[model samples]
Target: MFSSVVAVCIACFLAYIFNQRSREQAGDKNGKPIPGPPSLPILGNLCDIPKSHSWFRFKEWTDHYGPIVRFKIGASEHVIIAEEKIANDLLRERGSHYSSRVFLPMAAEYLSGNMRPLFMPYNDLWRTSRKLMHRLTMPSMANSYQPAQSIESARLLHDLLQDPRNYERWLQRYSGGLIFRIVYGKRVQTGEENYLQRAIKVVHNVERIASPGSYLVDVLPFLRYVPYPLAPFKQEGMRLHSEELDLFRSLLDDARKELETPDVLKRPSFAQTFLEEQEAIGLTFDQGAYVLGSLFEAGTGTTAAAMMSFLLTMTLHPQWQEFLWAELDAVVGDRMPDFEDIPRLPRVRAVIKEVLRWRPVTAGGAPHTLTKDDEYNGFKFAAGTTFHPVQWAIHLDPVLYPDPDQFDPSRWLDPSFPTYKRPLDKFPTLQNFSAFGFGRRICPGMNIAERSLYILTARIAWACKISKAKDSQGVIIDVPSYDYTSGFNVMPKNFAFNLSPRSKLHEQVVEERYRYANNLIYLKPKL
Candidate 1:
């Protein structure tokens, strides 16, 4: 009762304070030189943090600040880029200059301990790590995984049809299974008692610890001076770190043992790629473990998150779902979508494009570090400044995507629309989505991710009638799209929906293709 009263009081106080600032700065007022929100005390707009999601917070600031908003998160200063053109200018044109990741003290010591790339500082180590990711994720190199990507997609369709209620789990299974197979020539049939979940759970534990208030050790480094008992986060972080070391190293050890038998090392994955180049790269066994672990964290979570978002969107936006189904029906008919089929499908491609835009996996894309002092528009960014991609704000910008909140693929459908570009994997593609990141830090798994989405989305829409399950009153409860979880990976929290076979031929097409594709994946877990 006391805590509730205090919380209410605090909310009232903050609302009162913010309203005064909001009113005064509602319009082009004192005319601050740069476009941004009005500051209040040491916190600035930091006190006006958004609840539910980061996108809304970013939008709030963008509305108040314009395209380029400068703000503070604790002592650190960050520049949020909202406009698409400006975002491209910063993330693409100046990506290399701003590709370095900030030294997250909380993550480095507690989460990765130099075992992951997401938090690793930009240097020769990161560059080498980036090279390894490129071998699998870069478009040209990514083509090598088409066999694995396609097979996994077929498995995704098979599993979903069997247990539609477990669609969310199945999506993760497909992504996790594909990553495992690609990395070690193994498959993940289930997430429970499954190496993928155990490993990913550790990553999730680490993500939870790194939340803004997860530990004060992040904001105030002085806390590190305190003893372990005094700093609870340090203790927790170290415990999580140990778990990470055990999980990733255990997986690598299993793969290494398996490599002794068949042509395991010959497999195409970040792990195998790194192993082949380990001698030349000069990465120690421990470092190699972390690098592969980073791939697991980066590779598995984000892609699965996007897929869940895709499912949610399809359920909510029935018209777009219908259009995609019609497109799939017309284009592929009863056949499964393969790598070659990607280019031929335009409307399906547009759906992918819209998903990346409408409900992106990451709200504010991975923060970028400025390598050199440079000028963008009139503002000069100093070296070491971590620039935010602001994907959440940019995707919702009115100038580019009018009524940004609306789930409208028609924006891309209309050729007259200025922001309309070619669909991904061909001319315009998913790689362009800032969510995977930019320049030096672009996701290396983009190709495989695209192929995975294409195969499953094409098959799902072609085979199943995915509609929202209505409640007792016949209300369209399932149709209302849901949002991502509170965690770093933006996933559809959870929902129940109805699904059915699109046609008689659809089942045969799925069965024939899945049987052929299923045999291609080989899981090799120790007894």
Candidate 2:
């Protein structure tokens, strides 16, 4: 009986391999194969996928192959869209078939409980979540959040002035605090807050689990069905999910309690609105909690990462600081920048755009799955084909951006560059920007994010000068241009840098503004 069982198991394994090979051999109906590096049997390009900086690898593959390159891992077909035009063509114009996300067994199933709209499949739940986010983050509503953004920007400047070495931490606090207030009707005054730390933990956990090839189960679906005794990842994921759920629920409960208070003038929040209309919105308590948590998760880290990248850029290229100062000094001398000044400050806007283009936080871009068979150019792809509109490649495309490797804000400022456009007021905007993503799945919080970047970048530039740090020997420490943390959103690895107030006036202004903002009625409450 043992011998017979072993024979049967071996036969089944062989049959599975044969089946996968058969599918691979089956050419597209059009007889034009999508170009890619040749794959090995069974593994099928699995070994070729990089565990870190996958976007750079994807760019190389796309350059060697065509813009639309295809490769297989197990039975899955993955396509990389290198060109912005092609990405826009399929992921945007034909969004109906390409908006869905590829499922990850570890991240989406066990960790997220299929509740994170960012990773959820295109379905009723996703639609409902998207609608809620859209309602909260529309341009008009985003504009309403500017007062909060401004206050936080002032706090950011104050934090940097007090402790410049921990600028990264302060940036994280700024983004976390802003999103926490917007999502839960509470405040995160410092990075040391317990709730803020909990939220940051959640973001870090998700980034780790969701990173491509983080777990074997993500690529091999069958591993997810393994028994608990053999699958420790399953246990870890469930524990994380439970912890995240509790935190989200607690935040929602707090929001509910605040709303119950009568005659209290409170800043409006997404959680407050959701709790008030939960029944009408048709989401359960858990679903609503995750939706709000998702917003906080999405907003916090990426914004901080972008801001950090901005600091890195400034440290490496201090010449741009003079250009920004020129604009700021001419437009609103001796005063900190406000939203009103954004229209007149094209250089500030261009710098933000250029930073996003230069080193996008989500360098790989999110994966989109095709819902039905589709043909692009001459190649045909079947339903469930995964597509990655690689931001690393698209942003660095030489045709669209000359001297693609150079960090040139002039691309947006000067008309000589191909990316340049007329009418500076609106042309350098982040609307429909490739970094925020494409199609129906595009980030809904882009309005809030753009505003945050603008205000924070402008304030930092106005108040201080960033430069390379000097060691005990008084030699400037070199900063690596491409050394970044590996994850869904990448930030520059810790590097030596110095930040100081440009003048005594700038220091005094930051102090006065922070104190004045704190005295406001809305800012008085810790919550």
Candidate 3:
């Protein structure tokens, strides 16, 4: 019986491959095939896809094959968009047809139970989730969370002043605490908090499982149907799903309990709003829990990673730090910077924009699946084609950004550069920034992320001096400009750096502000 079953599976796999090949041979009406590297029979481009840092390889392909390139792995076809205008033309101007996501059997099904909005297809459920997220994260609504963000920023300054060696930990705590407060009406006081650690683990797991070629079952979907005991990946996915669900449900339950108390001094949170309007929003309890959980997951690490890149940039290009300090001293004087000061501080804003464009957190753009057949520039693509608007390629395009590898903030500040725009205040802003993403599926948390980046960047520049570390010999240590971790979202690896207060008075102000923030009624308590 087992032999017969094995024989049948092989037959089915062969038949599927043959059918796919036949469809490819039948040319589209236009008969203009997309350009790409050569592929072999049966395996297609499976051997070409790297297990890590695939973005660099994709950029190389774009360089050789023009802006739009196509390759196949197994039966699936993938396209890479390397130019900014073409990405905008398809993913934004024609978003309705290119907004859906590719289906990953492990990450989307077993691990997430189809509840992770990032992996969901462009269907009613995804639409509902996006609508609910927009309610809390839109620009107008995002402003309501500034007080919480300010409180967390104060803590960040204090943490760095106390222990500058663990600057990465402090950044993680700041982003985690702010997101937790906005999502569950709770605060993450330290980096070791149980909830924060668990959430970080969950995010890491999802990124690992969802990465291209991470799991064989993702390409060969039939493997998912094997018996649970025989399939280790299936068992692992199920275990992770249960743990993630428990975490989400527990956080939601705690928020619900807090809302039931009349004298709780209600702090506004996504959890509270969702619980109150879950019925009206047309999502079940589980769906709402995942929506809130998704917010926490998406917002936590990406912001912290970008901030890490900022620190790395400051270390590498200390000249920019002087530019930032000059702006902050002029616009923000002695007090810590806030949102109202953002418009007047163009250099500070420019530094943030340059950091994002220089080392984008998501170097490989998020994949968008074509929901219907489409033609662009006389080339035809069938429905179900996956598109990756490679951020690494577009941001480093030599034509759009001359001397693309150089860390230059002047591109946004000077009229001589092609990227420059007039009225520095509005031009250097993060709105519609390429790093945040494109189209209808652009990051909903962009407003919050931008605000966090601005406040942190400004305050840090005002209070601290960022420089390269010195050894006992008083020699400056070297920091690798391109050394980054391997993941969909990457950060600079731990490097030696010196973060110190600019003056004794600056340290005192950080302490005072932290104390004042602590006294606020909305700042206490944890879920």
Tell me the lDDT of model 1 at 511. 81
- Of the candidates numbered 1 and 2, which has the greater lDDT value? 2
> What tens digits encode model 1's per-residue C-alpha lDDT throughout 90-123?
7788666777876676788666787577777778
Residue 355, model 3, lDDT: 94
TM-score of 2: 0.95
Candidate achieving higher lDDT, 1 or 3? 3
Off by over 4 Å in 3: 1-29, 261-265, 523-527
User: Once model 2 is optimally superposed onto the true structure by TM-score, how far is the C-alpha of residue 15 displaced, in angstroms?
Assistant: 9.7
lDDT against the true structure, per candidate, is: 0.69, 0.86, 0.86
Error of 3 at 260 (Å): 3.2
Residue pairs with backbone overlap in model 2:
none
Q: Which sequence of candidate numbers ranks them by lDDT, best first?
A: 2, 3, 1
**Order of the predicted models by TM-score, top scorer first:** 3, 2, 1
